[model samples]
Target chain A: MIGRLNHVAIAVPDLAAATATYRDTLGAKVSAPQDEPDHGVTVVFVELPNTKIELLHPLGEGSPIAAFLERNPAGGIHHLCYEVADILAARDQLEAEGARVLGDGEPKIGAHGKPVLFLHPKDFLGSLIELEQV
Target chain B: MIGRLNHVAIAVPDLAAATATYRDTLGAKVSAPQDEPDHGVTVVFVELPNTKIELLHPLGEGSPIAAFLERNPAGGIHHLCYEVADILAARDQLEAEGARVLGDGEPKIGAHGKPVLFLHPKDFLGSLIELEQV
Candidate 1:
């Protein structure tokens, strides 16, 4: 069910600044920013050796990231993403184990153009987990 | 100057149960368990694509992980590990940027026998980050 770690998403107050911090200061190369209209957020990707770090900023006041930032003023980690061999099968297994998953019965296309589904934090010991099929 | 992500360590109360949960339910294969005598904790690894998930359990009453679990009984996501190409260079850069590092000026050999250092959560907007040189 679990494949590889897809990416680690961090909620940032400013995507550009965060991206710049990672690139200029940390020497990490930055990928072009992308706006996810569905999620009402803009994200910048910083590629690392085997994984990528996603810096997410809210595009609008109603954005989910905005609400998350509000609850966590320091803008901590948002979620952990794990690659899954089969999203539906993984979802079924998680559901059978009584884990609460976000979204309807379908997995949506995520920022990386992969099928992604989120599991509620309540189900995973307070960690918001995303399952991505790669 | 990061290498490849070594592993993402999650602080869990029950190492055996967590290991079982991941294996029996998620279909992730388990690796042999190892105890970090220096850290006063035991750990189990679950290897995935490109990375591994470490389940940490405190070994003694005064273990640091025990304190962490007390604060967050739900056992949420603990920290993110980034693989650095050069541990010293990366640590210097982070320190120059005013990030508070946990270890004293030197990276220690972690569970996987890689040089590792931890940055304070205060410096990373409430997210604890570990840098590992693989």
Candidate 2:
């Protein structure tokens, strides 16, 4: 079962503009851009009182977000991450319930260096969901 | 300044299926459907530990989410709502920074009965943003 809302990832075409919009325009504390080469994206963390908003931009060739940005040139909300106590157990339960786990159905070390798995968007009302073990 | 993330609104094509997905599949505490004739959408709140996920379905002839659903039949993330200390001040600051507020730039009573204003997606990295006074 999901515990807390970990973060909402928004894929943006221009990382600097997105960061400025959140920091200067919206008056939120934003972190410097951090490149997650393994994840094929650069991310900026927008810190809120309760949760985080991750601004993502494509990095390197075949970046995961490149296709998403192509579809939504202005960028858009990419995925929602929720914290789970035991990700393996959660994955098993979700699988048993006929939910498709993405990417070989294995938990990979996520951006935060925690085990995480992504669920199929089709199975989740067209929204991509990530489950991270906390 | 934006404080807490009020909620993430997801517009779903099928309210019942989306509710079941959150309650039964994801195992989150979901509220009963509430019809908001004024907002032209029926909503279900999926409660998480820190924030809420609002599931919206079109209701009435000119529902705001109707076109969104038409573009994304499987449903999708519609917008992100952030809590602000002073709605008017937030609006003024955002506008001063050249960010366009949706509608007439006046705060409307949101579904939660709080003064809320929507920012244009173009100014917010292609994502709809709602600012609620808290």
Candidate 3:
């Protein structure tokens, strides 16, 4: 079951501009950009009182977000991550309910270094959902 | 300054289906659908530990989300709402920094009955941002 609303990921064409808007324009505490080559993204964390907003930019060739960026040139909300207590259990339950889990139905280490699994957008009202074990 | 992330609004074509997915599939506490004729939306609130996820469906003629649903028939993340201490001051400062506030640059009563203003998506990397005075 989903616990906390982990973080909202926004894939942006320009990371600096997105970071500046959140940091300066919105006056939020934003972290320095960190390159996650494994995940194929450069992420900047905007810390909020209750949750986090992650600004993501494609990092290298064949980046996961590159295709998303192409479809959304101006960038958009990519996915919503929710904390789960048990990744494997959650996956099993979701699969049983006929909800498709992405990536071979296996949990992978996410950007936050937590075991995470992505659910198919088709089963989730076109909203990509990431379930992270916290 | 942005404080808490009040809620993330997801525009959906089918409110009942979306609510069922969040409540049963995702195992989150979801509220009953509340029709807001004034806002032209019927919303179901998924209450998370940190914040809320609002599932919106077009309510009446000229519904704001009608166009969005037409574009994304399966539904999608519509906007993000962040709480602010002083909305007028926040708007003034954002405008000063060249961030275009949506509408007539005046805060209106949002779904939660709080003063809120929407920022232009162009000035925010294609993400519609709502600032609500808390």
Candidate 4:
């Protein structure tokens, strides 16, 4: 089952613009941009008191965010993440219930340096759902 | 400033199916459906330890969720809601920073009985943002 809302990721065409909106415009604390090659994204974290907003930009031509941006023309809400105490248990439980986990059903290290898995958008009502172990 | 993440809303074409997915499949605690005639949405809240997931469906012919579902065909993440300590102060600050608040720049009572205002998706890197008074 899902735990806390970990982070909401927004895909943006320009990472710097997105970062500035949160940092300068909103006056929120933001982390320096970090390239996540594995995820094919360069992300900046906008920290809030209770949760963080992840600004994602495509890192390469094959980046998933690139594809999303192509279809959307503009960046949009990319994914919603939840924390789980035991990811394997959660994955198994979700798998047994007929939910499809993305990427060979194995956990990958996420931006937060935690084991994370993405569930197929179709299974999650057209919204990509990520589960991270915290 | 954005406070806690109040909820992440998903627009679902079929509210019953979406509710069953979270309740029966994920074993999440979900609330009964409530209709907001003014907003033209019928929503159900999935309670989590740290945040909530709002399952939204079209309540009338003019419901915005209807348009989103028409384009998406499948339900997807609609928007993210954050809590604010002072709605008016947050509004003024956001406005001063050039972020356009949607719906005449006034806070309306949301499902949680809180005054809430929506920010333009275009100014937010394509993600609709809702600020709610806590």
Candidate 5:
């Protein structure tokens, strides 16, 4: 089961522009951009009271966000992350219930240095759902 | 500018099936479906500890969710709603900062019976942002 709505990620073509929009214009407290080589994306977190808005940009040629940006030039809401108390339990429960997990059906270290897994968009009503243990 | 994440909406073709997926399979607490004629959509709220998940299905022919589902046969995350202390003030601030407010720039009564306004996707890194007075 999903716990808190962790963060909503927005895939953007330009990290600077997106960061400026949230910081300078929207007056949000944004974190410095951090590149996650494993995830192949650069991220900046725009902190909100109860949640966060993650601005993502492609870090390399094979970055998944690049493919997303290619299809959506303007970028868009890339994914929604929900915090779970026990990710492995959630994964096993979901798998038993016929939910497809992305990537090798194993948890990977995410941006927050926590275990995370992505659920297939097709299985989740076309919305890519990410589960983060926190 | 933005407060808590009010809800993440998912546009689904079949409300019943979608509701079942969350309730029966995911073991989530789902609300009874409600129709919002003005918005031309039917919605069910799935309550989470820190936030809520709003599942949306088209109510009429011109429903926006209908078009989204047409493009994506499997449902997907529709929009992100953020709670604001003062929506009108927030609207003016965003407008002054060059963010185009959708639908005549007026806050319309949303499903929660609260004033809500949608922002153009192009302005917010292609993510359709919704502000709701809380």
Candidate 6:
């Protein structure tokens, strides 16, 4: 079963500008930024009471974040994450149910070092779903 | 600060079918249904651990949900809600920051009897944000 909401990911064209807006304007404290070389994306997290807001920016030209920005010019919500008891188990369940997993076999370190796996939006009615193990 | 994620609202063409999918397919328990005459929407709530999923269907042809469904035929996510300490205070802050509130004046009882208000998508980039008070 899915637990609490882990975070909401937002795809942004400019990470610095988005971080500044979330921090200065929304009063959300920005966490240390991290880069995922495999995904070719950089992410920063803003912690809230029971969830966080993840800001994602493309690291290179051909990254998925870049494609997402191209598709959504206004820089909108990318995905919704829910905490799970076990990342691999959730991945297996989703895969068995014909959901496409973005990453390879294993779960990877997501924002705030949480073990995370993403299920493709096509399988979930246009809403990207992420499972994170806390 | 926001307490937790109150719910994620999805706009669907068929409320009964959506409720069935959430209950049988996803194993989520469906809450009692409610209708908002002012918004022209009939909604069903699916309760999770910390957050609920709201399936919104239009009551009339000219309703906002109808317009949203017309814009996205496949049935997409509509809004993300955050639980606030005080709905009115959050609404006031958002309004002072130039965010447009769709409803007039006071907070009304939303799904599950929570006082709620919606911030227009135009005010928050392209994502619709709802503030709910528990």
Cand 6, B chain, TM? 0.79
CAPRI-style docking class of model 3 based on DockQ: high
* Index of the highest-lDDT prediction: 2
Cα lDDT for residue B91, candidate 5: 91
Docking class of 5: medium
lDDT of 4 at B85: 88
Candidate 2 C-alpha lDDT tens digits along B1-134: 99999899999998999999999989999999999999999999999999999999999999999999999999999999999999999999988999999999999999999999999999998889999998
> Model 5, A1-134: lDDT tens per residue?
77778898999988999999888766778999999998899999999888888999999779878888999999888998888889999999999999999989999999889999999888778888899998
Candidate 6 wrong stretches, greater than 4 Å? A95-115, B1-3, B103-109, B112-115
lDDT of 6 by residue, A37-116 (tens): 77788989877766677888888668877877888876778888878898887777767765688868688887557888
**What is the DockQ score, from 0 to 1, of model 2?**
0.90
Q: List the candidates ranked by DockQ, beginning with the highest.
A: 2, 3, 5, 4, 1, 6
lDDT of 4 by residue, B39-129 (tens): 8999999998878899999997888778788888898888888888899998999898888998788889987788999999999888888
Q: List the residue pairs that clash in candidate 4.
A: A125-B75
The Cα error of candidate 4 at residue A124, in Å, is 0.8
Which scores higher on DockQ, 1 or 4?
4
Candidate 3 residues B48-88, lDDT tens each? 99899999999989999999999999999999999999999
TM-score of chain A of each: 0.92, 0.99, 0.98, 0.93, 0.96, 0.81
Candidate 4: chain B TM-score equals 0.94
Tell me the docking grade of candidate 4: medium
Could you tell me the lDDT of residue B75 within candidate 4? 84
> Candidate 3 or 6, higher lDDT?
3
Q: Write the per-residue lDDT of candidate 1 for residues B1-134, one digit (tens) a residue.
A: 65566677788876777787778866788877788887777888888878888888888668767878998786767787878878898988888887788957788887668888988886665678788886
Candidate 3 vs candidate 6: the DockQ winner is 3
- Single out the weakest 10-residue window by summed lDDT for candidate 3 chain A: A103-112
Every model's DockQ: 0.65, 0.90, 0.90, 0.72, 0.72, 0.46
